[model samples]
Target: MDYLALLSETEQKKLLVNFSLMTDSSIFLLNENKELIFSIQAHNAQEKDNKSEIDIVDRDDANKGKGSISFSPNQKDCQRLLKDLYEQKVPFSCSYGHNYSLAGEPLIFHNNFLGVLLFAYPTSSTSIFTSQMKFLRQYLKNLFVCHYEMDNLSEEVVYNYEEFSLLTEISQLLGGILEESKICQIVIEKIQKTIPAKSIAVLLKEEKEDYFYLVAAKGLKAKRLIPEKINTQQGICGWITKIDQSILINTGQDFTSRNLKLIELIATQVGFSLGNIRLSKEREEILLGILDSLVATIEAKDPYSSGHSKRVSYYTQALCENLNLSEEVKKELVISALLHDIGKIGVPEDVLLKPGKLTPEEWKIIKNHPKRGLMIVKNINSFHNVITGIYSHHERYDGEGYPDNLKGEEIPLAGRIIAIADTFDALTTKRPYRKAFTVTQAFSIMAKNQGTQFDPHLLDIFLSCVKKGKIKKIN
Candidate 1:
């Protein structure tokens, strides 16, 4: 077994120790092959052994105790124990020791019989044997009852972890790919790994309305649920998706009601797990939509810079592709470029849309947007790490920029990439304050500032992309 699994078995030992303390005797459980699985040696047993008063029978000893220790399935006691075990189909068997003069039951498992759980005393009287046999039977009954409900929670935890890992795999495959049909199919397949569903479907909220349409489905696909408009309060699945809870169909109870509630205890658990997955997907979509809206709002403030954010985003994506970044990194770069100007929201509209040169005071307020954008993104928790790009997009290579003059390699690489994209797009796009520069003129201006404003290596890559027509210069 793995280390964690072995560590988990320690709880079984603790259980045995507690049993020993309660019964006042050493107890042990062994597999059917007679290997010790757990043990709790009694203090009194150690004392008797130290005194050398009790003769312990070693399994390998030649001078064995005559017929008392022989093993035969046909023996009267063995036959009786086997019959009881077969009849109950449970871990229950009896054994008596000639040396220690004790009687107890062994827990029979699929492979081996668990160790002998014996109670010891003297062996002089028949009445003692009769009473001890009765006590042993009751002890076995109680132990079984106690442990029947044991380890269930631990087992459930294991199942939950497996389900979580599977969901993560599905998300990695479907997230950000922009393929709706494939995303829906992959999600349905992932759900099947957890449960045997009769059918599965995804109902996306329709555009510009309070309705949901069935976009993807599996099993009986008759378009019966297609274009189905459900109120938030109607049906199990509808209510769950609306309120962000889990849904379970009841097939057994109140057939007339159509909203039957059956086996709620089992259904509730399944519903909660599925509900969590649904909520997680919804949260991702909401965050991305908010990011897009923020970028559009920033650009909308100035007619001259209407499509400037989108142009920068396109250039950033091309740069990332030329650099051969991983798919996840490429997606992150696209998002970062889109929000590079988010701080513009904090700048005064008069300064932002000014058709004339700005005064020193106006310039200072404009410069403060980068810091404000960083603060805004940091409040989101998940977007805190990406805020570096928004904050440092205007920093010069020689550390002459505002809000912490980070120089050269001291700035984050993502911030450096965004700086190049933002400058390239702004220089090529016409503004109310000034006419746009030609592609060659813009390149010349950036080349003059290389190593002083932009990283030298990134400038080299930019020139190569421009030469290869990878990044188009628009006027």
Candidate 2:
């Protein structure tokens, strides 16, 4: 017997004894693993007859028969019985054979085996097997009522595993997707597959805003959820939204404004997942915005560098379109290029504005900006993709660069694209140290650097854009 049977036996006697009153009743309970350990005699007081209770029957009494007969429990027999019980499913009926004439059939309820009972009937009373089988049918119905309290443990375990796995997958999905509505829709789709809820929602309490918005919801007739104002105990959904709880309603005559245990349990899980998603998303947004704002501020500090980041951002998007990149990739490229010069925030104002050539040490510090920018953005949960681009934008196409010296395809496509855009914008725009080059002059300078500082094909594409005015001076 497993540990569950042992614990259940101590607390489950009165529950088991109730089945003892049935006419000719015998019960066998199976464990969660389906092992049959004990049997009970509900009413075993009937007498046996002479011709049927002969030598073969009496001799068999000394030991339970090995094949399809009452037998002492062995490891092999236990395993075999467990497998049989599992295959039979719940609420099965079978005869307990004995050598004596008065041996009776019993009903077995299988569900982690709370207890079993056996009832005997005298063979003298009925010779027909149909009458005995009729007695068996009645007991089967009563068995459902007897131990329904124990729960379908095996089924519960299965459902728990499915629910946990679904939550994990949804959490991972949320990590990659940023749109609140889409996140909620995916969550609702996942939940609907497991639970029978007509509608699902994710309500976020923006405490500073002093309002709760329905970020996501599903299964409603309307395309968008109507806003539910947050206050204490307003309405069913309102109360749930405000207090971070789950609400469930089961419609029927017996149900009168009360929550069922099952519904409450499911609601708790849903509410927790919703709240967690809201908080996590809020934190990521705040951090990402701070990083981006700082980078933009740094770029804005010098008049000569004004709109530099934005220009790079625009060119990066144009190049991404030319390359036929996916929407997600293009978005990453835009954000990455926009913040590519964030490391300049760490450079001294004097060095940034210096009209003369820099010393080797100052140049070294300036060169380390990409590495510094990477460190800044990498910590933000939502900007990991942008970090790669910011860190490697200075890398050359001909296997020459600092901060890992990654070259050519070793650099990410986003990084390589930003490198071209950054250099092009730098040449076309006037700086504190140098006059802005004319369009033709900038193109000539870029062409000379092709296959060395810049990717050869990319340089060709850039030159084509110049001739076609796809990339033009911002003047």
Candidate 3:
């Protein structure tokens, strides 16, 4: 498709000069625009060309140069002749002014027109031209076709490499994503760079929903209003058709084929990514069932702690929302809160339900619950992030809490946020030893241990949420 654009000017001029030299016939090369790119005068037309200082007017630049015949053959007549010759698309014989006879041939590749080549000879040399014209025309056509094929091959290589490389990068990126909508957004954005579609959209169907929802939509033509949801029967096709009313616009058949292939590969990758996400969700649901059973056992053992983990999860989720955390991270933090006290399952029922304050010997066993919770779920693959909040919920902010005594920022963020939620629920809920602290009293108590027991910034946010009624009060 590049024609002479991809080649350097020196290379194009050298090519034309060689053709003129080898044939000993004056040659003029014009691109599809009818702009005279090169004009070399060979011995055949030299004497005639020298007779007049010819001023060939350029259609593009409005500058005057030599060669081609003239208001006196005009750019309009020249353009008309080039167009007509291309339509015929074969070597055409014609008179070049009154002094010389010329023949023109179309340079073509795969039914696509590249440009036209014109050879001129003096009228005195016309008798010797018929045989030379046929040979020279065919030779020039063959040469151009060969050059065109090479260009096509080179272009295709670069295109394929870029397409493969882009798809590979996209594949690696999609591998790490788990959300269905996120996968669609990422995949569609990559497709935009390689495809020439007017608009692109990824529509996904949920198993229980009768309509397809638009996941991501983009492109120059994408600004047009598109429905957010479409029923399955909305112009949906399951097969390819070859009807005349088809929406396909083929700018280049081969080029378009390659582009379509790129789209297909990307679509397949997205489908695989979506499939992986669905499977992951399925696995996660199954794992949550197991974690729920474990939490139920712990709650059943200690009635006072009933609904404690669930309340903590609710509060943690509220904090995540107020913090504007990403959905994925928020989801992890919430799950971690629900499973934070699961280690109590390993504590003896007599000690856990002891109706009175425990001694230091019993307190030592209570402190081991966080580490025990870690050991319980540590083997589970999907609960890796949940383990942190489970282990550190009891750890204080200063270097004085729990098995690790991690100071300041050494604690995981999930642990830090869950600590505030866990403490708030504990303070608000009734325990065997004392009545529940009112919301006002709970805040007053937590406010005193801002940095030593809780992260100061996070505690402030918790207080803000309660003030804004984002976290509902128990009192």
Top-TM-score candidate index: 3
State, as a TM-score between 0 and 1, how close model 3 is to the true structure: 0.72
Model 3 ranges off by over 4 Å: 1-134, 165-177, 186-196, 209-211, 218-234, 238-255, 323-328, 398-400, 410-412
lDDT of each residue in 365-391, candidate 1, tens digit only: 998988888877888875765777788
Clashing pairs for predicted structure model 2, backbone only: 25-118, 25-119, 26-117, 26-118, 26-119, 27-116, 27-117, 30-113, 40-118, 42-118
Q: By TM-score, is 1 or 2 better?
A: 2
Backbone clash numbers for all candidates listed: 3, 10, 2
- lDDT by residue for model 3 (154-256), tens: 9989988998899899989988888787888787777766665556677777668777677877762545655777666556421122231224445453346
Q: Model 3, poorest ten-residue lDDT window?
A: 237-246
Using TM-score as the yardstick, the better of models 1 and 3 is 3
Distance (Å) between predicted and true CA of 455, model 3?
Answer: 3.0
Judging by lDDT against the true structure, name the best candidate: 3
TM-score of each: 0.46, 0.53, 0.72
Q: In candidate 1, where is summed lDDT lowest over 10 consecutive residues?
A: 254-263
